[model samples]
Target chain A: MKRYAPYIIVVLLALLPFSGLSTYMMHIIILMIMWSVIGMAWNLLGGYCGQVSFGHAAFFGVGAYTAGILYFKLGISAWWGIPLSVVVLALEALVIGFICLRLRGPFFALATLAMGEVLRVTAENLRDFTQGTLGILIKERTWVEKTWYYYIILAIAVLTYIVVKKIIESKLGYYFVAIREDQDAAESLGINTTLYKTIALVISAVLTGLAGAFYTNYMGYIDPEVVFALHDISIITIMIVMVGGVATYWGPVVGAGIMVVLAEWIRSLPRIGTAHQTLFGVLLILIIIFLPNGVVGDFSKIKRALGFGRKV
Target chain B: MTPLLEIKRVSRFFGGLAAVMDVSFNVNKGEIVGLIGPNGAGKTTLFNVINGFYKPSRGDILFKGQRISGLKPHRICRLGIARTFQVVKPLQRMTVLDNVVASAFLRSDSKREAVKKAEEILEFTGLSSEKDKISKGLPLGMRKRLEIARALATEPELLLLDESFAGLNPTELVQSIEVIKKIKERGITILIIEHHMKVIMSISDRVVVLNYGEKIAEGTPEEVSRDPLVIEAYLGEAPAA
Candidate 1:
């Protein structure tokens, strides 16, 4: 019964578009799925591998640009960016991992944050290549309806979910956890910490790049600031994973759903729309204080607090 | 038979201080050689160098006649040398079985095979009863046993036990001695760093004593225990007539 939950949810979501939902509702769903993809990717590296990144926006933006540039320069369809960005993002992941993976803990996080900022600045400066700060515009979008985009991202999310799940259940997954728990111990026990860490980073970056490519095709436009926004792309990716659950499989999905809905609801307010970020900040603070391990991670505590189960 | 491990004048320095200075020793195949020293006498530092955690500032380490000094820890581990930590470093969130299974994966390609091997190791280490328990929740004695279980899962030819008996109670100490004996019976060479004189004196076929980063004495456990230099190092005074 528990095994079928994800498939059941996917089936229901697949049928959701035919339920006469508004365009706005479909857009929110798409955003939710997309955020979850990014969240899951981040979880692989940060939660499991213990290499928390604060610069996922770099991969996200690089992926976005890979598609955007191919469209703007070569006049090819941006959809090709989805497949092409894998190679691009992998090289990016390797270079970044080589430089940033040497630093541990918060220093690694800060280094990634700086890497994201550097990419953002680089995208803005390279006018001939990235169209400068004006960003790349996809004049002709592939889809007129949100339904197709919704299905596309849902497919990507499902793939991400399966891949992440398989890896976590394998021996590679054990190595990641071992490295996270104690690197020296992992090494002494014959696990190559650096190699496993790089594998995690590469897988994570490539998945995020896929989502970025999808965003390029769906949104029809992307500026460096929009795609590479520190708080929005990178930190929010962390937040989704954190709010969902750190290492649990379902954490990011639940986190993305709540965060996307909350963001949409807060932004829909007339006078308070601009203050949505402030609301998010408060909510994040409360979640951290109350559920440091996120919702799924602290499910027992939440159940107890709500008086849902039999007493111990 | 060639020695399983040979350390020739190994020295590890931190800044200007020599933590392990010009220390040399060897462990013959299938022998349980005890490394005994007072605190700050560089026993752990020497273990670190032997296991490739620290590169020796001078001298060479030979495992099966191959120079292994300065090799990465994992590479050294793959070359059949495995060591436990002085402070136990069990993968805290993982179960004892999972911890050993993770190490078992080093040799076995199949997860099922690794798991089967890990269970056998756990049984050997007498940790089969607590296999499902998270390592962090284990008592100090069990945690040390888990450490040995983990290292043994790597199928090492040379097992280096760093202070494996540090905090064990008398019963636990006896159990550990039996476990170590069983490990030696499997034909794996054992080099152990221990402080408890009685424990080391009982199980060790030979004992090497270090003082102030140097090999002060080396002989049978009985001989080294009665050595004048070892007595002075441990007691900070000459032995009474």
Candidate 2:
């Protein structure tokens, strides 16, 4: 039963769009899955590889721009951005990794945080190229109904989940965890820490870029602030992983569900709608203090606390 | 015949201070060479130079006649040199088996093969019983042995042990010596830096002694122990008449 949980969950998720959810609910679900994709990507680099990056928005923005530019400048389908972003993000991740991976711990985090702001500023200044603050708006969306969009994002989510699982189970995953454990020890054991770190960065950035590309196609509009957002994209990506569980497989998914659902539900509440951010901040603080490993990561502890499981 | 490892006048400087100065030595194939020195005598620094952790200020380290002085630690590791740190570094959160399997990845890309190699190393290191336990929870003696087990899993031709036997109890010490001998019997060359005199003297084929960042004596264990300079290095000069 435990082993088949993921398959069961995926099947349930696939059937959700057919159950006649309101368009708003479908939108929220789509956002949940999208955040999960980004969360998983961040987990790969930060949780497992031990290279915490706060500049994922750079890759996200670049991905959104790739699709946006395709439609706006080249007269191509914005969907092409999905495949193109992989190549674009790989190159970007390599360059970013080369600069940031030389620093460790908080320094690496700060470097990545700066990278997002740097890209946002560059995009704003490159008026002819990125249209400055004017932002790209897709005049015609690929689909009018939410069903097709739902299935497409779900498919991408499934693929992302599988790829993350496969990578984490293989020898590459061991090298990642080894590097995370102790870089010097990893190098002494014949693991090329730098090469593996770059690999993690590229894979992570590409996955996040996929989500960004999908976001442009789905939402149909993106600007430097919306796409390369520090608080909205990068920080939320970290929160999703941290709240879900740092390194556990299912942590990000559960975290994304909580984050998306809570934000939407809180905003819909009549009296407390305006205080949602404050409430959300307090909730996050409570979670971090009590369940530091996130939901899935600390499930057993929760069960035991609720008197449903055996004590250690 | 070319030695398995040749350290040629290696010197490592931190600013003006020479941590290891003008050090030279050679370890023949299939020999266990002990590197001994007083507390601040640059033994670990010399090991660092040989393993490529620290670049030599003015010399070369030739492994199988290939100069490896400026190579990255991982590159040197792939060239068949594996080392244990003076402070044990276990992949703390991982199980003991996984820890060794990570090292075994050096020789095998297949997970099954790496796991098999790790299992064999764990058995050889006498840690099979504790293989499933998280390494961070392990006692110091077990962690020390796991360090050697991890290094062995890399399938290294030259193994550098930096104080691996430092914190072991009497029974663990005997077991460690037995494991080291068995490793030698398998034809791997060893260069160990150990302060445990009894363990080093008993197992080492030759002993090199250092004092004040310089080699003061090099010979058989018996010869090195009897040398005036080595004695003076260990136990300061007798009061002047």
Top candidate on lDDT is: 1
DockQ of each: 0.90, 0.90
Weakest 10 consecutive residues of candidate 2 chain A by summed lDDT = A275-284
DockQ result, candidate 1 = 0.90
Q: In candidate 1, what are the lDDT values of residues A1-312, reduced to their tens digit?
A: 998888899899899999999998889889999999999999999999999999999999999999999999999999999999999999999999999998889999999999999999999999999998999999997878899999999999999999999999899999999999999999999998889999999999999999999999999899999888899899899989989999999899899999999888888899999998888888889999999889999999999999995678
- What are the per-residue Cα lDDT tens digits for candidate 2 across A1-312? 999988999899888877989998899889999999999999999999999989899999999999999998998999999999999999999999999998998999999999999999998889888888999899998888998888888898899899989998899899999999999999899988999999999999999999999999999999999999998789888888878899999889889999888888888899998887788678779889999999888899899999999868
The weakest ten consecutive residues by lDDT in model 1 chain A span A303-312
State how far residue B129 of model 1 sits from its true place (Å): 1.5
Which residue pairs clash within candidate 1? none
